[model samples]
Target: MKIPNNLRLIVNMRFYLTLCSALFLVNCSSKTDHIEMVYGQTGTSLFQLKNKQLAYTVKKEGQMVLDTSLLGVTIDGKNLGSNSKISFLNQDKVTLKYALNGIKKMADYKGNIHSYEITEADGFKWKLEFQLSNDGVAYRYKVPGSGSRTVLGEATTFKLPESTRVWYFERDSDWKLKSHAGEWLSADISEMPTVSKMGPVQGLTLTCELPMGGYALLAEAALYNYSGMRLKAIGNNSFKANFTEGDQGFVVDGTITTPWRCILLADDLNALANNTMVASLNPAPNSELFADTSWIKPGKSVWHWWSGKYVDFREEQDMVDDALALDFEYNMVDDGWEAWEDKWKKIAELCSYAQDKGVGIFVWKHSKEINFPENDYTIMGHFLDSVKQAGAVGVKVDFMNGQDKYIIDFDEALLRKAAERKLMVNFHGCQQSSGEYRTYPNEVTREGIRGLEVNHMQEGPLTASHNAALPFTRYVTGHGDYTPLGFTEPGETSWAHQLGTLIAFYSPFNCIAENTQFLLNNEAIAPALNFIKSVPTVWDETYVLPQSKIGELAAIARKKDDDWYLGILSSGSSKEMTIDLNFLKDGEYSAEILADDIEAQPINLEGLNKEANLRQWNTAIPFKKLTEMVSVEGKVTIQLAANGGAAIRFIRSKVEVK
Candidate 1:
């Protein structure tokens, strides 16, 4: 069905009759005038013109949304709209292996819109799945039955014409262009207005103009991560992903690997948390098909004491000792170790001590420093190995500004090696994930956005927008190591807000990033940590629950083997949140409340600024219960000061067997 450029027009208007329910047909002159469209029976259509010029219209059934002047074809609702003009150098030179969905179950979806025939070029064969959906178009391609090991999708053969041009749409006029190789054009529209006042959809547009007179415009929500760009590659492969664009696409394509598989998320996490996918697609986990996956484990119940700019191992040892006392399984020693290799030996000395206390230590290493003689990859690897040698379980690799293909390959290889050596990984300043954890389970966490730590360190107060914005924005593609659950100084909220991080921030190896000495002062809040630690990061389900951001409030819930941990948070405001306790097994349970004292309480942020006694924490609150939803409701009201919030933990009681 490839259209020849010489063909003036192919208007098989008859196909339109088959699809348009007769009501969609419009009376027009039979004389092929300025426009021509040939529709197909299998939910596909083709459009072409002789002079390489075009114009058209696309409309959904009931909505008044109209997109006019579109010159590309669409399958279902997906538009294969490229801004770059494509020329077929060899139409007859087909490669059956260069077809889409050739990798089979590894990259192809079981339910897809189109099945394309394989093209043969020399001895190679390729399959291409070019389909359209109500939302956008997608191109899936693969080389049939290639190597035993996983090869980059770009290694296939989809030769582009000598020169092709492409462009994308944009909402903002004045945009900055950055240097990204293989990237013809780049624009940023982070400040666009919301398309709708509510609901999942927020609109932002990105346009990429190719050198060859063509362009591609991707219009999506203003949110981050959930959006993407399409890339035309050599051979038969087309790269499409969220954030990652270029040859690096082979290393970290979000659509193919980490499209937030809801089932995998459910199996890895919990069931009640599964509601986040009501707005989008979630690839089901492959493990559940035919095996007991109990070995598939997860956890984020630890403490991360950052070493970046602050490398005090002696202090860190004290912190480790404190974490061990708190019964935490993991403790991360953040950035800044190469400079203190001397300190590492001392930290290494206490490694067995920490382990003897049942605490696993995680060291921090720089990704680029892996090559320094004093700090190269070998020594860094040895450093990690030494930690392992000393009985630590993991290392958090950070500060990788070089997110190149080689860097990605090296990082993945590093994780694989570390896993083989029985060590876990946490990435910082790294590229977006590609579900490599399913391939290498030890890659436990990542810091991909401005997380809570940013809020504590000399920034404007962490707005409710940061929490409300993440789900549709950052959390769409993969897990985030947002280092949740700390009610110490510098936070503009209460212990409850910190508690909610256990639910809001989806980090498997959770970090109670504050000192345990701080929590011991508030034993009531100590139980909140126990509840947080008890809840598994791997859940049966996860949910971005319905709530209001008007008054600094957010909530999330996780399900773990019949126990549901629902954590609710409110920032510097007194607002009521309604929880359907009915979701729990019809039973009564104790609710641990952590709120702020409404009256003025002396709080300090000195410790956050490298000063002693950062902030003295104090809170006043009324704790009550609800007997009936209609008659009386029990909620902890927190009129918190700036940087103050509240937390509530729903501890599910065991149900009696009948």
Candidate 2:
């Protein structure tokens, strides 16, 4: 039941707590100054708001996980939750359809919801809504009043047990407002305040191990029109929400609704890897805007930029021809294409040529050229129109580096513009994901994780441990365009290991960055070509093996239709891992494996970047092959070299004839 604004506050607090807890079926909480708010059940989890205080506490399974922390937002230099009155508004159920353009077995979102009202001292009002589910708790602030408001910042904070361990990324020096495209780091929650000794510890997407029973992945969701939020260490085991522009702040016009502050609670790492809480907070696509999803079928692509970024009209046609041979859906023309003498005319000719062979062209556009606000959006509109007119299926928007409210707004506007032109989107040089894809189906993939392209170009080699950490850390938020499989450079891992990345990382518009001529004709890769050719870019289901650990090893199985694809990545040292086929159907099935050859000496290929040498290559580290018939109770075992990986495929067999 909702408390009316005119309802008088009870003069006696002790009596009010008792009345609300014992006699009334109210949305209010349990006895005395300590009020239990989130879904008032006896056990499990509860978000408590202490009476006579504006702070909040969190408990799980009757164990304290978080101590009292501040709860309020500072708007125009006014503290909204201070000297204010709060009343429980109402309770309802959270229900959402399982709709997505592509990704794992589409997850469902259902929970119990409760609302509270916070009326400031001057009578200004806003709403706080919390949704509690078995997966976790998500809450957000919604201001009912309209008009432009400069948000100073939020007072929300998280105080955890000192013993909690955290896995996160330090903020990149260039991008102070965001925490993405950086090396992964770890520290105890207690050590966070002093982490400047290690590096900056401000902008973080943290996955923390609670001292009690479960894990909490602290992140934000539905980041459409607000300054992006990151956590700043505040001494001890506490963190305060830091806005994108720091003190200067950003303006939110019209209705002010912030993204959901989420804690994805899970019992094990597997559940954590598969958490859908981020997507749960965002609304589904507008039915009228996205009535036809037939244009959204996802598939693999052949990319020219990932291979090197040097593009010309003639070279692009070769990419399209290679895509046709591989039966791929799209051919990406990355940066440097615009430098062509007649870029548009050539792009149109290439798109026309690829269209006849069942291939679509995805052109690249720099955000600096079209995404700014001065030109009245005409530049962006014209670019989208030109691509659609050229028969291109998608646009890759690059160099969107900030997360302040203005940049966030521009990102959404670009998606809307591309959607109207029926063009898919791949956001590169962008901020980390907050499950915005649930609302924008045209967004096929995005770059938030430090992916393969960076690794190939950087001075150092990509460590397998970083690759191993992705499944649990980065991928949990949403799809990562990790443009996997860069074969030209090799400093770590065997050739087969690079092939395995094609299955490990989750990117709907999967782009292969290897030398195309080498990938097609290298006799050494012939045995594994079939598996690579048919790998599923979008999955029906995913299972993280129980043996998996962050930054050490990642063994996962994904299902598409009747076949199962397994990707295993191991780091630090050569080790043996096992796969139990317990999830397979009852009948026998055929399995084909492409794995690291532990004993073979890797062949030296210093000239892989040279076209003359690439075509002449016929030898490399042997990809150990295995074929067997297995059942639900059977197991398949493989050994991995240091920084090694493998890809396996399984197909169920038919019943035998009598």
Candidate 3:
């Protein structure tokens, strides 16, 4: 092969050219194969998926119901979906099987995950992930990038079928300070009514009953370092993305994966209550950070704020002693805890006192104290460290008052920083939970509901109707700091109704809004108090009984370890119902029940009128009895008075009673 040098060079060049041509052809073929392949999943073809230019179409019942809803992101002035060429990169389908921890501990989350990876012409990559469960479907977009990226807006749309009836709350500009107020209304999507311009804009979650059998819920999940999402009506049964804007809009560093824009489909209301997709869509806890979550306990805490008293050391110790006697985990020193001279020192002393009694202390601070200018990163970090050094277990940051991108970022920053210092957080006067606790388990609870504290200022009292609706609506999103188990007299609902809230409404850092004197001195509900003390805030499993109605009644059963707790709430009028205990293992069990005393003076019928003075409504009553029964057949019946409720604790019997 030792030919002339020129001839040999020419031969080598030709050989290289031929190899390059073959490699190019193979690459072209690979790209062509990826583009041509139809990536999708089918559950009996009732749900069909297809994508082009990031525009996805979902076919339901053989009809293209959700048509050409484009999913994209806007950065600066450039739109990714509009300006770039899109190509399919890959597709995969798998079953996601996992267990929950924290608020929903011991719950099983199983679903089928379908992931579609695509690339844009400008080199931006996106992974559109969809989870198809028996209950509904949810999808989120993930993008991997470097450096800081300015996110102008998100382009996620939902085009519903015409003639759908929707239920939703209007958003509040002052979302941080007040509970999400206003009533839930049923309206046709095509002719949606306008919300009050003085208050914040529309809320995030929207429920629409499709003309076709099932119902659909539009909500978001895993909101972190991004603006909370709200849907704006774009006419023609179409809604577009309306993000909560921050000071500099929404920006992300390194990577920006938007929260899951979820559409929960349900055949019945009960299915909506049972769906855990919101929590499942979020990433699990960092086991490395919370390896031994034993210290992360969820139980009742005595909050001094509801009493409207500036808690001095003496009052603080009384509450701490009360929590200790009640076997409660924490005693919260709210608002005025820092007003005392040498406040930090006094707090440390109280912490020591409480710690010895096996009770933890939660200190309170304004949200402004942890945000920029007022308290920068260095100051916030030092403050948390100081609190941790003081032996306080958690911090109740309150009065956030906004749902803009800035406030969202601030809320997330507080969680992350508190976690770094090994402290728990309970956000008051803040937006609803977007499954942020799944990422940072240190977030104990958040107050975004119209709770017991509102009794002081609300024109009309919070009703059982509102309470009944919460379990399916607000509570479905995440933990509601409703501040349940109040023993104050002249309460809005019957004593039994308040007791049931301990189980119906979930909050890890559950706050008992009444003073210690009420629980100890009230001879009428002492047995009921004992039941409240024994109830666990976090549950392993939850079941919504078939009798649940959005604005009328809510009956729920939650399990922790071997015991089951049941809570039933009724509105408008007295009622009777039976609960099936079949969810329990096949074994005899002892049930301790506390129900309304029907013999007590009936709630003033005139006061029940919405126009009557709220003070006239009777909220306190004597309990009928603390009855115990052996249940082997797995069924029990109880009666509830008007605006009343019941709570029961079921424990497996050690001896099988014949």
Candidate 4:
């Protein structure tokens, strides 16, 4: 979609996009035991072969962002690239461009790519490839031999420089965990506490403040047809890849290609938030299967499962009505819908009813019901066909709790089959999808973050620290199905905080998990409800505020059309934030700021605050609202209470000719 001549918004985002479009010259040099590549105006990567071991260093612009890091992967119990004769194969200059309906709308890639072949002592050889782009650099390995083989492990280690601070936590600390969700813990790499040797590190993303300068985020990308790769603290101020499925290793048939280990380098928070490296590394959506992506709609949905209500036909019908009233795009019928007598017919009736009302329905399914130990696309296809017949626009497949090869294959089959049926999907209780949405746009979101559901299961409200952590750590990889709002039970966060997440978090299907009946009846919230209704689930662009810090603050502005929604979140104490309106076009905007009302005492809702009661706080929401005129150069001051939030909608005001 091209921008209108009148709405020239990109001009206002000069500072936010300075680093994104710098023209650079590609340069490369190769020696007997040294290979150096530089992506001019972006970054440089240098590889060294010392004592027959291969190690590499990365730089952002001219400064060193990564110290030398050892690289290798073990195949059939033999070390390759760790201590082997690796010779350069070839190098190439490449360019890529694509568009997305979620996150950043479009991405253009101009970078340098190269490959090297390493010969094992026994004469076995494999190719190691690396690619560099504006946002980051990535490396992967490709095995050559055909037929089945059992690969053991990887020696791929990230040797962090001394004195760099890290924010990471041990994932899967409990061995029996089907877990990928975890909050970040901060410390120096040496002081990094809780290094669980038994657990797998999944997006432990602590934006490491490199000693030399800039920030580097170590992450994995394009995780397909392979058991997932996670990191573990190796205790030498380094992190190494660990496949948690087992030490025996994933059995592979024919030549196997490993996923890319990406090091996302950035100078500031905005660049980090806007980095498209992960999605860029993944393959584009299969154009053959989805010849027309018009059916793929990204918008807000009305969900009541988090409300913990029995969604009978009447109740779901009420919810659909609520969706219509709220101008929501979807209405979801969660788990246990199949238990209904004559389930398919009843569901189909409900779907028909919803369709007539101009609303779509989403149904849930257990993975085991459709995916057997043996690959069964036919069963999955049948289920998908039934849902499409029943009027479901999407499917929420629940309990997809592993990252093994079986899980990988099952997901691939389901996505292809679901797309063929024109039904979208969300993998509930699933591990981190690692940007699979780029490959299958119908895979809108997955449950990997310790979000709203877990937020409800715990004692008291979900901590603001946990809420603040997402944008930097978890969200950088891909969207998580947080189901981020609940008014009837605001938990510990303010009503405004619940509202802010709709913009701060990036999920194509922003399924708000709240009882809409309450929001409708409460006249107190009507003033600020328009923002909720107008916020888009996907954004054209996003700019993270300089005030933002992981686990401390989350302030961001997202653009769609001519409007920009700025969401502010603060952890721990109250804060006063002054947002520079430099990102706005040169025009007056009716800025609606929704903030916490400290003076509005809880009218009999204190008990719900102490112990979350899913029903009461709906009517007792005490939120404050203000509207004023502002412009491109103006600044807006927002006062947030302890563990509170604020949201502002910048709607361009029409200027009349006098």
Top candidate on TM-score is 2
Weakest 10 consecutive residues, lDDT, candidate 2?
Answer: 39-48
- lDDT at position 169, candidate 4: 44
All candidates' lDDT scores? Answer: 0.41, 0.76, 0.70, 0.75
lDDT by residue (1-658, candidate 1, tens digit) is 8776555243445556455523222211122322221112112222223433222222223211112222322222223322212211111211111111100112212222333333222333333333333222333332334222222222111111222222221212111111010111222222212221221111122222222322222322111122122222212212122233333233323222212211111111122123122122322323433133332235443443532326566666666676665666766766654456676566667677676776777787767656343323466567667767766678787766434345555565576457656777888765444444444446677765556565445432344435543433344445667666544443445555566556665666666666566655555454455664465665654443455231244455555565555555555546555554444555555665555444534443344323222322323232222222110133333343343344445555665799
TM-score for candidate 2: 0.91
Candidates ranked by lDDT: 2, 4, 3, 1
lDDT of 2 by residue, 1-658 (tens): 8765545455466678777664433333332434455543212222335442356666665666667676778777887775556666787988765855444767876688877776666778788777777667777888765688888998888888878988776443664344277656667888888765434345546888776756778889999889888888887688889876878888888777899887777777778877888887888888877777677658888887655537878889999999988878989898878888877888999999999999989999888899766665888998888889878999998887878887788899898888777789999888778988888878889987777765455333556778888887778888888887766664465676777777778888887777777788878777877777888788887888888777888887888888888888887788787889987768878999889887887766666665222323333455688899998899998888878888888888877699
Better of 1 and 3 by lDDT: 3
- Point out where model 3 deviates above 4 Å: 1-54, 59-68, 83-86, 93-104, 112-127, 143-147, 170-185, 191-200, 246-248, 373-376, 489-492, 602-614, 618-622, 626-634, 656-658
Off by over 4 Å in 4: 1-32, 41-51, 169-177, 193-206, 373-376, 603-621, 656-658
RMSD of each: 12.5, 5.6, 8.9, 9.0
The candidate, 2 or 4, that scores higher on TM-score is: 2
Point out the worst 10-residue segment of candidate 3 by lDDT.
Answer: 39-48
